[model samples]
Target: MTRFSLNQWTTRHWPMPDLLAGCAAAGVDVGLWREPVAEYGLTRTAKLVQEHGLTVTSLCRAGFFQRPDALEDNRRAIEETAALGAPVLCLVSGGLPEGSRDVDGARSRVADLLAELAPYAGEHGVQLALEPLHPMYCSDRCVVSTLAQALDMAAPFSPTQVGVMVDTYHLWWDPAVWDGIARAGAEDRIALFQVADWVTPLPEGVLTGRGMLGDGCVELRRFREAVDATGYTGPIEVEIFNDELWAMPGPAALDLALSRFAQHVV
Candidate 1:
């Protein structure tokens, strides 16, 4: 379980304090989101994590480039990530503007803005990890929807300043994922690795449809092996988003996730 990290969203409703205590007791790291961190107070949360001897694997986001204030917001996120001692800041490049159908323009904007933020991230000792959401999200959530696209965007910057995020839930459907993983490894552009199974009959809105490990058709171990083969020894974060899982007590949900992770991913 040394490499295991519980992404806070997997148990979204868990109170901050309890989540910290649980992760520390389990001897695993955590992947935190901006919302809960803001609500709990960043300084307090950082202190608590230190007191409990827990490490934060990564910070959940600083993108959504469509917003007018995205650049400023991402800069703040980089500072927050530095404060938490986290090494990576995940980026979810936001979708199109209000009614704009210029998909190419939106994607180009992501690259342009990233050029501005990558140096800032490097100065703060943080890596901007570009996450490619599933293509279905392209119209509404993320314009970068493939690993290749993410790598291409990261190519113009140093690997330490900009890297691509590898999330099984999002890349599972891409036939070129294996090759992309290899390319990322060769270029040293893999910043973070996250896992979540893709389940059928997706829930309404499709936001909370992520399945726990082993509950779906994803070859969890295969994905793990692919990442590991690239010499990526970083934390493997479990980032499921299921309503039923959130309904359970935090500790229970974590235990189940760990068990499933060991059985299917390890």
Candidate 2:
């Protein structure tokens, strides 16, 4: 199978300690989230991961530059990522400010915000990885909707300081995705690769309905091969957001994810 990494959200109901232990037992690395880390106590969480000999592939996440507290929150996230020994901090740039329809302005703000945080991330020895959500989420979830846009936001910083996440779920519908991945690789801007299939008839809030691998038309292996062709030897994070998986027991969910990842994402 591919170098699989379990994204914390994929098993959102899994307690922090169990998640770490499960990953260790499965011989898999993990991608962690801030809320769970905080709930478990950041220092303690970091220590537990270390004790389990588990690698924190990436920390999820910090962006939302439209808020006044964005900078401070992101700085803290950088510190958290460093403390956890995670090499990358995933960033989901916030959408248009309340009552505002200026998409261009929101995009511009992401560039400015990245410019400010890139240096701080570098200081903390973390790469800020910009993740572009699907276009459907452009209004309320993320202003950056395409891999190309994410790459543009990351262009100002060196790959070590800032980079892009190639998430199959979000960019699968983009015709230019292959080219965008190539450009990101050529520019040395790829930081993470996330795998999730896409299904239609999106659910309410359009956030948690991601398909299990091979359950949709995402061309999973093609995406991986393209990413690997870029010489990106990073962890392939499995980030399914389906509520069905969430309701299952953590170990069962992890087993299912691992099985699908091996069958479809390799």
Candidate of highest lDDT: 1
- Residue pairs with colliding backbones in model 1 are none
Q: List the candidate 1 regions with Cα displacement exceeding 4 Å.
A: none
> Could you give candidate 2's per-residue lDDT for residues 106-157 as a string of tens digits?
9998999888888999999999999999998899889999999888778778
lDDT value for candidate 1?
Answer: 0.95
Candidate 1 per-residue lDDT over residues 98-124, each given as its tens digit: 999999999999999999999999999
Candidate number achieving the greatest TM-score relative to the actual structure: 1
Segments of candidate 2 deviating more than 4 angstroms: none
All candidates: TM-score: 0.99, 0.98
Counting only residues 3 or more apart in sequence or on different chains, how many pairs clash (N, Cα, C under 3 Å) in candidate 2? 0
Candidate 1's displacement at residue 25, Å, is 0.6
